[model samples]
Target: MTANLNLYSCDLTDISLSIETILQVVRESKGIDILINNAGIGKFALAEDLELDHWNRVLTLNLTIPFLLTKYVLPHMKRQNFGRLIHITSDADHIGFAEGSLYCASKFGLRGFADSVRQELKGTPITVTTIGPGRVDTFFNGKKPGDRPISLNADDVADQVMHVLSQGQRCEIERIYLKSTFE
Candidate 1:
């Protein structure tokens, strides 16, 4: 399937480019059955020290990009009455940390966006789910997999994504929170 998969590289931060990317996918695929907004970037800084450009960049990738993608794909989903919108958020969406004001704001906004859109699509086949994981063991922020014992494996979250996708048609998973236990 990798041989048949076509990937288009675009700067998602650029609204025009992002829209074009989505349009291209829709045109090639006929219609979008699922959308996973998994791309994100984090710039950690105290609220007082965060610059406007940094804040805008974080919000653009974490919140605005997802919103735009959803907006573009939603019409097709609504037309077909079937779609799955998945947004990979962070535990920062639920709680704020010392130097994560910008990150938290963007994540929190995404969580809220998922919730509101879910409501709007209620009674439809389309489902909006948010998977918020805590301290995933990835290269995020230059942290390695085993850098923190309390961090979760990337596979852990992938399992949750599969779980959400495997649910029965009658079942609607609104949100899921994942965190690693420190033993």
Candidate 2:
């Protein structure tokens, strides 16, 4: 039988709700073998002009929620000796843009967190991977014109995820960064 898929669509800014939803999935499902943390939000504003609420919302979803979800899922993954975590980060984590202080901070923190967790999971089948992509044409920050004609598509990221999953248990890819050719 196919494992049950419990999809939770909520404002990821709600930490309590996010944690509760993940806990519910863990409790109801037979087990969780993979987790794809693809949820994130961003705001473009000068660091000085950035609103506190916007920063909090971005950090909560892009950072804390992932950490909490990983914390709750680790036991299941450790028990089964098998798990895959794919974190969707951004190239901005490595570089910086004029109005991306909050976004970059959150993503950078997430990448660091993923790396530390991967190190701690050595010798275990639980794998942690962070995938960073440049200017994907998504409604991530509201729809916009295809500024970069050669920007990576969302499918490109999906293919990366599939590639990671296809790898043997002995292989663990830690990080992948995809950048747009135009930039």
Candidate 3:
């Protein structure tokens, strides 16, 4: 399916810093029916070796960006009486892995963020959802498509998102946790 695309490359961390720019961008889009907060980064290093920059980058991208985007989009969603905020977190949100202390911290924070936001939006038509998927075969980790064994494919992830988007107005899905299995 083909859809209209709006691409902006400004620093999400600076999104708040430049409120005018963000508001202008938001104005350009006008409004959003569905927001997929999928931008994230992983700095795979032990706690000691993890630099402050890496830690901040991961936390800002994984945790803070979603919050900011959600904040910006909710008003539009509220105005329309409908919206879906989907956070593409990772299994790290649920369980911490070795050399992933910083990564896990960011994801765990996202889990908490979703939990609180979902409750806050209970009476509204806006729905907050967090999808935590196990290792996926993507370019993020230097893996080529279809080259990994039994890892979640990109399309599978998209299908799951589409499922949420297809839900009726009365339905509210809180969370989806997917695990990869060897097949």
List, in order, the clash count of every candidate structure.
0, 0, 0
- What would the per-residue lDDT of candidate 3 be over residues 1-183, giving only the tens digit for each residue? 998877766666665663555576679986778888887788888899989988888888888778787788788888988999888888899898899899899999998998899899899888888888887888775567767758888777788899889998889888888877774
Candidate RMSDs in order: 2.2, 1.8, 2.7
> Model 1 over residues 1-183: C-alpha lDDT tens digits?
353556778898897899899888877875677888988899997799989999988899999999999998999998887889999998888899899989999999999999999999989999999999988878888787678757798899999989988987688888899888862
Q: Write the per-residue lDDT of candidate 2 for residues 82-180, one digit (tens) a residue.
A: 999999999977888889999999999999999999999999988999999998887778865475457788888999999999999999999999977
Q: Which of 2 and 3 is the better model by lDDT? A: 2
What does candidate 3 score on TM?
A: 0.87
lDDT score for residue 156 of model 3: 70
Model 3, position 178, has a per-residue lDDT of 83
**Which residue pairs collide in model 2, if any?**
none
Q: Candidate 1 clash total?
A: 0
lDDT of each: 0.89, 0.89, 0.82
